[model samples]
Target: MTSTVYAPHDHHTCITAALANAKTLCESRGARLTPVRRRVLELVWQNHKPTGAYELLPQLAQDGFNSAPPTVYRALDFLLELGLIHRISSLNAFIGCAHPGQEHTTGFFICRLCGNALELSPERMQDVNTRLAEELGIVIEEQTIELSGLCPSCQLAATTAKEDIA
Candidate 1:
């Protein structure tokens, strides 16, 4: 199966926007958006991809944040509670949510060719879960729907490279 791969954007803008939204939500909820939490969130959103907590630590250390694993874990837990991020169980990594501060079950479209992970919104999740429930009488409690195939850009590049070789 194939899906359109996305291009890189202003990652700085994305990280900033996500952090801003998170802060707004925390403030509205009377929750403390602590510095460690904010930095962790920023790091997660910075990549626009799933990141393991261990990998995230070095970035924090480099930034002069001498936080232990537990600190990062707490931050991740807070983000998960607020629906600002979701853990990709299969990969043991976390990805930033497209829409934060909303209730939604996470679904990912993970590309095998390039390892790009994309979030599926509520409408798409409903369509898929509805079919599963209707056909198999199975309610998806937690789903990690990672479609493994060549993403669009990778496919195009492969084809072009093949043509050139020929």
Candidate 2:
């Protein structure tokens, strides 16, 4: 099935929902989601795209938080532990996990033309693991699979340009 590009959801609601979910999960596990760490997560999810640590440092500082690299790294680590975010190894950046309540693997569809990232759930990613395990005799533990290509918007623009020229 083809993935449809979705309308931008309410950012305020997104953050609120994510924070609420994280808080509930933390409480259930006796984990604490501190203020600084929460702010960092907020910044990372401030934009739908993947965010680099360096990019987030300045924003954190601007918000009266420490701008140190370690501070951001530590916060990122905590969030990762809580399954609130995932690192995009190819980009050396981080993107918020789409599903927050349950533990699941995620796959990314990154648009080369627009840099927009689509987060897919574990169910959508099952085939990849099945194929990899069968073909390579490898049992996968963790994965951050990203497929890069033009997104629908860019494809539509290219098609329109070709039609206009014709």
Candidate 3:
């Protein structure tokens, strides 16, 4: 529910909490978090950046998994279906959902420089959806709003560089 990518925090704690939450959600929902699926999730959470399927394939292969396209695809499908991960349309990459097991709209703030992605709270996107629905009279079934921009750190660095040049 919170965006922590731009903020300074414990990376290991975030990953550990996510994995634990995922395990609990899967068990409660009667879904099996298989070894491959679990590993894929871990790989996805390696950083706050989005990772493409092809990028993960080689990692899986190096980790002793089958590494076939179908195998990886299936795991991704399962993760997506469970709402454990989200695909960024623009990047064709996947990122772990900060808030799962809840119905909500997700927005991504992707850093153009570092490739870091931050998940915006659903409430932040609801306003846009409401306006569009009212104006276009269309129902939005699936939503993945991605906005490309520099994150706080990147912005600061850019500003610092400009200052030095001046």
Q: What TM-score would each prediction reach against the true structure? A: 0.88, 0.86, 0.93
- Candidate 2 per-residue C-alpha lDDT over 122-141 given as tens digits, one digit per residue, 9 for 90 to 100: 88688778898999999998
Prediction 2 global C-alpha lDDT? 0.80
lDDT of 3 by residue, 110-131 (tens): 9999999988877868988999
The CA lDDT at 58 in model 2 is 82
Better lDDT candidate (1, 2) = 2
**The 10-residue segment with the lowest total lDDT in model 1:** 1-10
Candidate 3: global Cα-lDDT?
0.89
Pairs clashing within candidate 3: none
Error of 3 at 15 (Å): 0.9
Error of 2 at 64 (Å): 0.6
Q: For each candidate, C-alpha RMSD in Å?
A: 3.0, 2.7, 1.5
TM-score: model 2 vs. ground truth: 0.86
Give one clash count per candidate, in the order shown.
0, 0, 0
Ranking by TM-score: 3, 1, 2
